[model samples]
Target chain A: MLIATALASVFIRDLFAVIMVFGIYSLLSAGFFLNLNAPDVALTEAAIGAGIAPILMLGTLALTRKKWDPEPHAKKSTHTPLLPLIVVAITGAALVYATFDMPYYGDAEAPSHTHVAPRYIQESGQEIDIPNMVTSVLASYRGFDTLGEVFVIFTAGIGVLALLGFLSDGSGRKYWQFADTASLRRHTVLHVIAKILIPLILLYAFYVQFHGDYSPGGGFQAGVIFATAFILYTMISGLQAVYKIIKPELIYWTMAFGVMLYGVTGLVAMFMGGDYLDYNALDHHDPIHGQHMGILLVELGVGICVAAVMMSVFFNFAGRGIRLPEDTKEGGQ
Target chain B: MSVVLGLFNYWIVIALMMTGFYLVIATSNLIKKIIGLNIFQTSVFILYISIAKVKGGAAPILEEGTELYANPLPHVLILTAIVVGIATTALGLALIVRIKEAYGSIEEDDIREKGGTT
Candidate 1:
C-alpha cells in the first residue's frame, strides 16, 4: 500500500491528490514504525507526517492553486524522464547490493543493537527511572543532541518568518478580516465542532507533553499536537478569533522564550557546578529526581518552542494576504 | 530464498527510496519534488527502524518482565528526525511560495525560460 501510494504520488499531477496520497504515505510510515516496535517514533510520524505536514501543504496550495494548477502550458511536458529513471535504478541496485553485507533483518546481534542501545534499554530503568527509555535517551543520555534538534527547528522557524514576515500586500486591513465572513457563514457546523474539539485536543496535547516521561509521546509530538489545536481552530473559526486570542507578538515572544528557557536551564545547571544540561544538580538530594526535573524542564521548553513555531509558520503561510475568493470581496463591501 | 527472507525489507525500502529519488530528479513540478523528498525520507526512516528491530522484542518502553526490546537509539534519533523533516519541508515550501511570487511560476523550465526578475 505504501509503495502504491508513493508510485501514484510520483505520477499524479493534481497537486491536491498528490498531497492527500502523500499524507497516506506518511500514515503508512507510522504503521511501519509500529510494526518495527518503535511506538514513540510511530506517534511522532503519525502526528507530524500525516497530520500537520499535509495541512501545511494544502494551506500553501490554497494560495498558489490559482496560479499553478490544472496543467498550464501543456508544452512543458517535453522533458524526458528516461535519464533520471536509469540513474535511480542504478543507485537503487547499488543500495540493494550493499544490503547483502548487512545483518539479517531482526537479528538481535546486529551491531546497532549490540552497542549503545543495549545500555539505553537495560540501564535507563535505573539511571533515568523513566518508563519510556526512548524519552530517557532523548532527554537524558543524548540530551545534547536533542538540544541541537530543538535549535535546528528554532532556526527553521526563524527562516520561515524572515521569508514571509513582510508579505502583506497592504490592502490596509488592520488585521485579517478572517471572520469578514462569506464562506464562514456556511461553516456553522464546523464552528461548533471546532469549539468542542479544540479544548479536547489541547487537553490531549497537555497529557502528551507531561505524560511523555511515561508514554509514547514527548515534547516533540506534544508541541505539534498543541499547535495543531490552534491551527484547527483557525481553519474552522478563522484566524481573526485566534489572532485576537494569541497575538502574533505573543507567539514570537513564546518562540524565543522557549529557546531561552532551554538555554537557561543549561546555564542554571552549569552555575550549580554540574555540566551543562546536567539535571542532577537541579536537585542534589536525589540524582534521579534531578533527572526527572531536568527532563521535565527541557521537555517543557521544547514543547513551548515547537507549538509556538508551528503556529507562527502557519499564520504567516495562511495570512500572506493573498485574499481568498470571499476575502477579496470584503474590500468592495 | 534465505537471502530474500532475510533482506526483503531493506530491498523494498530501497525501492521506495529510488522512487522518491526518481520523482525528485525526473519531475518538473516543485510540489511533486517536495513530496518525493518526503517519500525518500520516510523510507530511510523505515530502513533505520528495521535495523533497530530485534527478533521477538517488545517496544522500547521499559516495561516489567520485558527482557528484550527493540533499539531505543534509532527511535530517539528518528523521532527527532521526523520533526526536523517537517521543519525543513515547511522551510522548503515557504521558499517555493516566494519563488512563485517572484518568478510567477514554480516550474523550473518556466523560471529559467522567463529569465527571472521581470
Candidate 2:
C-alpha cells in the first residue's frame, strides 16, 4: 500500500491529487514513526507533515491555474531526467550497501550507543538535569547546529520577502491587503482554533524553552509549534489580522533581535574570558551550570528567530496578491 | 526466515524511495515533484521504523514484568523529520500557488515559458 501510494504520488498528473497523495505519504510516515516508539516525533510528523505542508501546497495551487498545460515545443527533451535518475540510483545503492555495515537493528553494542550518546545519556542528567537526551544534544552539546538552522530559516524568510517585493516600502504596504476579506471570514474554523490555540501554543513554547532540561520538548519543536499557530491565524484571519498582531516592521526587527541575542550571548562569553559561546564563563559558577544557562538563552534566541521567520514567510507569500506590479496594469485599481 | 523478511522489507522500501526520488527530480510538474519528495521522505521514515523493531520484542512502553521492548529513539527522530517535512511541503505548496498566479500554470515547462526563463 505504501509503495502504491508513493508511485501514485509521482505519476499522477493532477496537481491537487498529487498534493493529496503527498499528504497520505506523510500520514503513513507518521504511522511508521509511531511504530518506532517516538510519540513526540510522531506528533510533529502528523501535524507538520500530513497536515500543514499539504494545506500550504493546496493554497499555492489555488493561487495558480489548476491544469498543467506544457507547451508542445518544451516536450522535445525526452531523455532529460535520465542522467540525473541514474546518478541518484547509484548513490542510493551505495547508501544501502553502507547501511548493511551499520550495527544491526536495536544493537545496544552499536558504535553510536557506545560513543558520545551514552555519555550524553549518563552525564546529561547529572549535568543538565534533562531526561530527554535528544533535547540535551540539540540545545547544549550541539547548540551551534541549532543556531545555524535558525539562521537558515531567517534567510529563507528574507529571501521570500525580497522575492515578493515585500522588502520595499510601497510593495510591502500594498501586499498587506492581499488576502480577500470574504475568504478571511469564511475560514471561521481555523480562526476559532487559532484564537484558542495561539496562547496555549505560546505557553507551551515557553515551557518547552525552559523545561528542556527535563523533558522531550525543546526550542526547535516549540518554535515550530508557535509558528504554526501564527501561520494558522494568518491563514484563517488573513494578512490584515496578522499585520495587526505583528506588523511587518516588528517581524523584521524581531528576526534581527533573535540573531543578535544569540550573537551577544556568545560575545558576552568571549568578554568573560572564555571562547565564543562559552556558557561556562557566564559567571564564576561551575562550567556545567554555565553551559546550562547558555543553552537556555541560546535556545530562546533560536525559538524567537524561527517563529518570526516562519510568520514572515507566510505573510510575504499570502500578501503577494495585493501587490500586482504597477507596470502590468493588473494592480486591481 | 526472519532475516529474509527483514531484508526483503528493507529492499522494497529502498526501491520505493528510489522511485519517488526519481520522479521528483525527473518530473517538470511542480506538484509531481512534491509528490516524489513525499515518497522519498516516507521511505526514510520506513527505514528508521524498520530498524527500531526487534524481532520478538514487544512495544517500547514498559509495563509490569515486560522485559522485551523495541527501541524508541528512531521513532522520535522520524517524528521530528516528519514535522520538518510537513513544514517544507507547506512552504513549497505555498510557493507553487504563488508561482501559478505569477506565471499562470503549475506545469514547470509552461511556467518557464511564460517567465521566459527556466
Candidate 3:
C-alpha cells in the first residue's frame, strides 16, 4: 500500500491528487512503524508527514495550480526516463544484494540489538530515571546530536524566510492577502469544531511535551502538533486572526531563543562542573534529578524551536503569492 | 525460498527506494521530485526501523519483567531523521515556490526552453 501510493503520487500530475497520495503513503508508513514497535517515530511521521506535509504541499499547490492547469506549453514534455531507470535499477539491485548479509528480521542476535541497546534499556532507568529509553538516549546520551538537529531546523526556517520573505516584509503581504479569507462564514460547524478541537490539540501537544519521558511523544512531535493547532486555526479562521494573536516578530524571537535555551542549558551544566550537555550536573542533590531537569529543559527548547520553525515556514509558504504565466512582466502577485 | 522468507521486507524496502529514485530523476516537475525525495527518505526510515525489530520483542519502554525489547537506538536516530526529512521537504518546497516565481514555469524543460534564469 505504501509503495502503491508513493508510485501513484509520483506518476500523477495533478498536484492535489499527488499531495493526497503522499499523505496516504505517510499514513501507511506510520502504521509500519507501529508494527515495528517504534511508536515515537510513528507519531512524528504521522504528524509531520501526513498532517503538516499535505498542508504545506496544498499551500504550494494553490500558488502554482494556475500555471499547472493550462499545462503551460503543449510541447514542454521532452524529458527521457531511460537514464533514471537504469541508474535506479543498479542502485536497487546493489541495495537488495547487500541486505542478504543483514540479520534476519526480528533476530535477537542482531548486532543492533546486541550492542549499546541493552545497556540503554538496563541502565536508563537507573541513570536517567526515564521510562522511555528513546527519550533518555535522545535527550541525554545523544544530546549533542539532538542540538544539531534543532539548529538544522532553525537553519531551514531561516532559509525559508530568506526565500519567502516574512509577513513583516511588505513584499509578501500581498500574497498573504490573496490566500486569506475573512472567516468561515459558510460553515459555522467547521468554525465551532475548530474552536473546540484546536484547544484540545494544543493541550494534547503540551501533554505530549511534558510527558515525553514516559511516552511515545517528545519535543519534536509536540512542537509539530502545537504548530499544527495554529495552522489548523489559520486554515479555518483567516490568517489575520492568527497573526494578530501570535505576531510574526514573536516567531523569529522564539525560534532563536529556543536554540539559545538549549545551548544555555548545556552551558549551565558545564558551569556546574560537568561536561557539556551533562544533565547530571544540572542538579547537585541527585544526578538523576539533574538528568530530569536537563531533559525537560532541552525538550522544551526543542519544542519551542520546532513549533516556531514549522509555523514560520507554513506562514511564509502560504503568504507567498502564486506567479501566473500571463503576468510575464512582474513576478508573483 | 529461504532467502525470500528471510529478507523479503528488505527487498520491498529497496523497491520503494528505487521507485522514489526513479521519480526524482525521471520527473521534470519540481513538486514530484520533492515527493520522490520524501518517498526515498521514508524507505530509508523503514529500513532502519526494520533493523531494530526483535523477533518477539516489545516496544522499548522500560517496564517490569520485559525480557525482550526492540532496539531503541534506531528509534532515537530515526526520530531526529524524520524531523530533518520534513525540514528538508519544507525547504525544498519553499525553493520550488521561489523557482516558480522567478522562472514563471516549474517544468525543467520549460525553464530551459525559455532560456530564462536557471
lDDT of each: 0.86, 0.65, 0.86
Quality of candidate 2's docking, in CAPRI categories?
Answer: acceptable
Write model 2 residue lDDT over A101-137, tens digit each, in one string: 6556655555544555446545666676545555656
TM-score of candidate 3 chain A against the true chain A:
0.92
- In candidate 2, list every pair of residues with a backbone clash: A41-B79, A48-B86, A49-B86, A53-B90, A57-B93, A60-B97, A130-A213
- The better candidate by TM-score, 1 or 3, is 1
lDDT of 1 by residue, B11-113 (tens): 8899899999998899887878898999999998999999999999998888889899999999999999998899989999888878877766778788777
TM-score (chain A only) for the predictions, listed in order: 0.92, 0.82, 0.92
For all predictions in the order shown, the interface RMSD in Å is 0.9, 4.2, 1.1
Cα RMSD for candidates in order: 2.6, 4.8, 2.7
Query: What is the C-alpha local distance difference test score of candidate 3?
Result: 0.86
Winner by DockQ: 1
Better of 2 and 3 by TM-score: 3
The better candidate by DockQ, 1 or 2, is 1
lDDT of 1 by residue, A37-134 (tens): 99999999999999989998987776665645486857846458989988998999899889999999999998888888878887888888999988
* Candidate 2 segments whose C-alpha is farther than 4 A from its true place: A1-4, A66-100, A165-174, A177-179, A182-194, A323-333, B5-9, B41-103, B111-118
Backbone N/Cα/C clashes per model: 0, 7, 1
lDDT of 2: 0.65
